[model samples]
Target: MDSGGTPEQVLMGGSMLIGTVGAYLVLGAYLVQLQHYCLAGAEGKRKNRLTLYILVGVVTVCETLRVCFITFAAWRVLVLGIGQPVLRQSPAKTAPSLHILGSFIALFIQGFFAWRIWTHKFNKILGAIAVLIGLLTTTQLIVGVLTGVQLGRIGAIAEQAAVTAGRNGVFNQFINNNQNPGGLTPFAISVGILTSTVFVCDVLITIGMFSIFHVYRKRSMAPRAKSALRVLSINTLENGLITSLCAALTLILYYARVHPWIHMAS
Candidate 1:
């Protein structure tokens, strides 16, 4: 199996690409909302303006942190020649923070979806299920973040050992010690759990929201309204499918040993 490049380069380079694309998408969504507001006028905008701004702000803040961490990690690796251990350690520390923030944003977005569903159907049970699932994912992410912090602490210890044993020796030691309690297996398991939970939450939210939209489309009598609803339903489903696929792939990569890169990229 040819892996192509050093994992450090693969991870950092992949993150750079993801972050750039994410920034564009985040800003683009905001821009689209703004453009719609401009064309549709204040009354149409008033209903959604606050929510759109909140989405933009939350995504912007999360992406800012992501870019900052990726930039520093890249500088440390490529420019400073910090080696594999530092690359692994540095990103491991920051990745969970990003994961937590991303999960928080997901919760907010999913909750909004639940609220919308409830607003349409007035179904407390459905909304409660959506919110409950969102909370479940958030809790899992919090635990995963804590586990990652512990992993980072372990990495820091390994880093100290590396300083004494020299750069190349670090990998050798990790390979030997990875079965120990404070080693690679635990971190991988945590990541797997985290990503899986995220995937589940996304899938549930997608189903819930799409179901609501489907009902709305079926119930509408006016052709124009039905057509507009169809467009929205398609967009919602498309976006959810993309996000759910990413989450699924991220878990697959975690188990496959791609680790931090795939998670960051997603």
Candidate 2:
């Protein structure tokens, strides 16, 4: 190899470097947000204040662990295993587990939103929708954790045996391993659900926010109040829009018969 190394090495190395930097940047931003939240404290005498605090704490722990995992992966790929071809073929344990951790993070955050929606006043239809969306997010979280356990199993249970016996399994309905590369294993199906579930949940949250705020906007007489509602509605969508779009794109790519590894970009 030349002094620059092969093309694949350069690409992989550059990706690892950029990912590590981005992960730290995100961690820093999250810290700032957490600090701000603590300073602000509880907003009102809301009944779910305790639940909200617990959710925030869980999310903070998951975010920290996620960054630690990424740092460890960067260390493995760029420092410990630098220039080794095995890096190309062997997956890092931290890498796969990151998705599971991410699912936890998403689950907690959405749970917060769901709690908000439930606490806020809403019509029956919107309330029902929010409840259903919340249930879906919970189900997805369960599936994600189960899939992680399935992958990390340490017994004599063969993959084929477990999978074959899993026709009625909750997530197995999505896994159709009839063929080779195209066939969706439990892991692939779980990932696909994760992406789609994220997109669906975000969209529903945004819509619910809009619906809740629209009622207030319609009843308000003051122009300033209406304007504030307008801004808040836009902000609500903005908060979750990017996340939804990214999840949607990942889902598209995963189902498009493209390289399945593309989801790791999300």
Candidate 3:
């Protein structure tokens, strides 16, 4: 109904679809884990229980914010259809801030991976580097989101629904304005650093894990055990590659500026 460009359509629709599916998948996993823990009489050590609770809090907050974003977007569309000026005046006002939730989720998840790698007794230096990378990237992501939000609120960048009307030319013009208050250089630099560091961290973890698994497999005598380890290694490698690819793609789309919404959704 908005008659937006292909890129805008893809971004809006893709975000809706992903948000729905991702929420379900993530919450479903948490639900299953919670059920199992309950059935086991919550027998985990105190430290483990504390960690689980903290993680649950993080996931809950993230998912709740995501739902709010989806709801707000849908409401804007509906209001626009009904011929309201409110949406046009304050389009996507909350989205940039809300999007920071993704970075938080990534931080916690990546920190968990780092912890796992540390538990394996990998080189202490490498483990420290991985943690540092994760922290830096996450911090950069937050800064980028906040910067973009500041720009968006100041009219430096168009809102979510603004592009939906196929007004990309206006958006481009804003970006090109020499005296524009919100310069994109900082946001671009932040995203570049975050994505690069995240990719590097994931790669290091995957390689370290693979090498450890390979060593174990060679020493393993049981055929069944070796086969299981092979499967695990493959899964680990695939997950790492997928994460790296996503970060790379997000960075490309962002720097290229072909479709900023696409990168934001990523």
Candidate 4:
């Protein structure tokens, strides 16, 4: 399992988990605050607050799913041992698909919120970037699922061969040859590309967030409104930063060939 890799790797993985958890918790709290503020406000602001609630709900669900996927991947790695066939169809392949789906949901929610804020230019720019990233991520997920299905079929054939041939036939050769190949599959390449795209998307989101915060600061809203926006901005920035750090760690592990379990779980 490369447990002996540099201490940095261990710390990085632990920190990634902590950061993701913390970000989600803060986001949840911010949503609750929004709900309270919305209830206290006049009828005119209630509609906007309801929209924010829906957007926050979507983000919460997406992030929760993402954490669940990561946790499952880690659990599989621990149980199966590194490089073992954790899935007949390969969970490594399936994980990216979930990630892509979650990313798209998050993008949609964020775009909706940006639009509500009436930052038209920032909304357009962020929307475009989010759409591009979401498309690439979804493409990668589809590719991974297809590759995993093919590998599963091949594994099934090999297993049947072993049973019929008594372990000393072409089935052994097939199993040996298909032992993931270190980095030869389209799935692996797609994962790499998706990881890189995530980094770029994170950068753009950060910029958009900062721009939004600047606009919020210049407004002459009530103190409560100002405080709410500040809280929202802080939570959003933390979430974006944590996501980017995790993506970067996964990207580094992929290229270093340190084994997929360093990023995946089983």
Candidate 5:
């Protein structure tokens, strides 16, 4: 590969692209379904349909933003300077910040939807868990941005020290041992934690969705309401699973630690 990636590295990169695209397709389909439901004008269900549309629309935007960042990173890695990591530069470096911001926006939307659903007869514990997850996601967003900025500052300090020390200082030692062209830094540990938190939130949301489904199956909600809940439950479950898988894949890629493939590409 032009990026000095091995064939296997190329394959893994390709897989990530395909998987991300597939996720966008699923999200897009659900958004369309939500719009249809919103516009169906089913008498008393207008509010519910509108709420669902809003929730789906926010999630769709988040997913779209994520895809854009991923595409930019991929392009940086594959087509730009062969040995330079794509994420080391200005716009590429901003991608994660954008993702974190988008996640916070999505978290707010998810929380609002969860709150609306909490008045029903479903498991209160599940709803509480979902709400807590949303809160945690918001925290992660804030922490992620702080950590990224801190890491960037550290990189700048290291670069300056490398210049002045002529290769014999603490900062130079840190740079030699810790710095990567990809801009991976110790602060990225926080990002890993944030990603894990997102996965946990997705799992909690899925649990809440299933709890609602179980309650609906046994209870006496209106026929149309029950049908709408079922659609939401199914879509939520699918989205949660996909989100969790993506988080796991990202962590794996981030922490693989050795750039055997990065070097091969270079």
Candidate 6:
């Protein structure tokens, strides 16, 4: 791949193309979902009106920004770098990074679930565990943002990062770690922590939901309410499992290094 994120790296063009198309596809689906939600008239006066608006606003903005950055990156590589000279350059070149934005949105959504876990009636032990899960999500956000900042210091011309070359350069130290625990760089350490938190947070949240179900099951609720809880528990399991699996797969593919494009596609 082009270390500078220039178009000279035709070898990884397929990866960038695939990623760009995937971004647009996902964006379309997201927008459609948002439209449906809006049409549902949930905006009609409600107790949590402000909270709902904020949730929608934050996700829309973050998702839009992610797609824009990725699109710009693809265009830069495929169009601008087409006939450009491939002079040897510093290994630590800068470019727009997407993971930080992803981290922010995931943290926001998962935080909502964490808040649900906290607010719902439960034992003190479970309440304490919910708080712990919330803290872990916050920690993930902080680490993700810090990693983006660190990467920006060493990568790109137009978007985010800038080049800083050397054996000890930020980029080299980052990519060199290879996920080794003993010699991990700050970036790798943060990534490892970030992915771990994602998996653990989702799992804990799902378990909390099940606990909530168990608590509600013992109550004398209406049949519809009980039915809703059952469906919710199933939904939670599916969502949590898919999220955790993706994070694990991405981490694995990243460390495998079989093909640079493979990890990017993940």
Which of the numbered candidates is closest to the native, going by highest TM-score?
6
- Model 1, position 208, has a per-residue lDDT of 76
Model 1, 22-46: lDDT tens digits are 5456556656755774575654636
Q: lDDT winner among the candidates?
A: 2
1-266: candidate 3 lDDT, tens digit per residue: 24443444444445444544544554565566557656655664565767767786776678667656755655563345235432432335655654466667667766766666667644666577566756765675676567556546544345443556654343333332322334444445545666676677677777767766776788899999899789779977886787677667666766776544333333
Q: For candidate 4, lDDT tens digit of each residue in 64-96?
A: 666666566554433342354323223333454
Position 253, candidate 3: lDDT: 60
TM-score of each: 0.71, 0.70, 0.65, 0.54, 0.63, 0.73
Candidate number with the higher lDDT (1 or 4): 1
| Arranged by lDDT, best first | 2, 6, 1, 3, 5, 4
Model 1 quality (TM-score): 0.71
Return whichever of 3 and 5 wins on lDDT: 3
Say what the RMSD of model 5 is: 6.3
Stretches of candidate 3 exceeding 4 Å from the true structure? 4-49, 74-82, 85-91, 141-145, 148-179, 182-186, 219-227, 263-266
**Where is model 5 more than 4 Å wrong at Cα?**
3-44, 48-66, 83-93, 121-124, 151-185, 221-235, 252-266
Tens digits of per-residue lDDT for model 6, 110-196 = 788788888894688678768878899889788877766665544432122122232222232344453222233454566678778
Instruction: Give the TM-score comparing model 6 with the true structure, all chains together.
Output: 0.73
Q: What TM-score, to 2 decimals, does candidate 3 have?
A: 0.65
lDDT of 1: 0.60
RMSD of each: 4.8, 7.2, 5.7, 7.4, 6.3, 5.5
Candidate with better lDDT, 1 vs 3? 1
lDDT of 2: 0.64
lDDT of 6: 0.62
* lDDT for predicted candidate 3 compared with the true structure: 0.58
